[model samples]
Target: MRLFLKFIVVGFLNTVISYILFIAFLSILNYQASYTLSYCLSIGISYLLNTKIVFNVNRSIKSFLRFPLVYLVQYIFGFIILYLLNQYTKIENHIGILIVIFLSIPLTFILSRVVLLKKIQ
Candidate 1:
């Protein structure tokens, strides 16, 4: 429960950063493009916070390399949800992203925990 709470806090911080970047990029790009760019940029911050704060793990080149895979998977899942919501529902891009973010939190935390905490035998 405590770990989950920490993950939520880190996720909230990452979401805020990504949303700001998305809004900035939306000025010149479409929603999909903005989301992609913002998400990619925020992965670094996510990795840092998740490692140092949330998981309390030491940074390693191996873990850093594996980290973005978690985000990539999350991004794909979120993008599909975003697309579906925007295409078939009344939600707009801005609002749809918030829904997607909240929906993705659990999956993100689980994947991140596996990648960050697994010990190589």
Candidate 2:
């Protein structure tokens, strides 16, 4: 529970940063492009926070390399959801992104735990 809470906190911070970057980039880029750039940039921050703060694990080159797998999964699902919402529904890009972020939290936490805590043999 505590670990989950920490993940939530870190996720919240990450989301804020991503959202801000998305909005900033929206001025010059398409929504999808903005989202992709922001999401990719935020992955590094998410990895550091998840490893050191949420999971209390030391950062390693190996873990860092593996970390983005979690976000890649999240990004695929998130992009699908975002596309569906934007195309089929009346939801705006900004609101659709919020929905995607909320839905992704649990899956993100689980994947991050598996990747970050697994014993590498």
Candidate 3:
């Protein structure tokens, strides 16, 4: 129960950070980087928070290498999805952002459970 709560809190923080960065880059900066900037920034923050806060992952050689690898793959998939949605949808940017947020729930949970939270063998 505690772990689940921790995950939710961390996940919520990550979502806010990612969404803010996405909007700022896409709307304000007018940087048509196509989500790359947001993905890089948010993924880094999410990995850091998830490792230290949510998982209490101790810094170790194996874990360090593996954790980032898992995050990279997950972020790639997430970026692709977000990009495709932005391209294909008629939804407003704000609504599209919200849609992406909901869409991320299962992917986030699965990746966090199966990869990030999995016991390192």
Instruction: Write candidate 2's Cα lDDT for 63-110 as tens digits.
Output: 999999999999999999999999999999889999999999989988
lDDT of 1: 0.93
Residue-level error in angstroms, candidate 2, position 44: 0.4
> Which residues of candidate 1, in runs, are more than 4 Å off?
119-121
Q: lDDT of each prediction vs. the true structure?
A: 0.93, 0.92, 0.67
Ordering by lDDT: 1, 2, 3
What is the Cα root-mean-square deviation between model 2 and the actual structure? 2.2
Find the 10 residues in a row with the least total lDDT in model 2.
112-121
Estimate candidate 1's RMSD in Å.
2.0
Candidate with the larger lDDT of 1 and 3: 1
Which pairs of residues collide in candidate 1? Answer: none
Candidate with best lDDT: 1
Candidate 2 ranges beyond 4 A from true positions:
119-121
lDDT of 1 by residue, 3-84 (tens): 9999999899989999999999999999999999999999999999999999999999999999999999999999999999
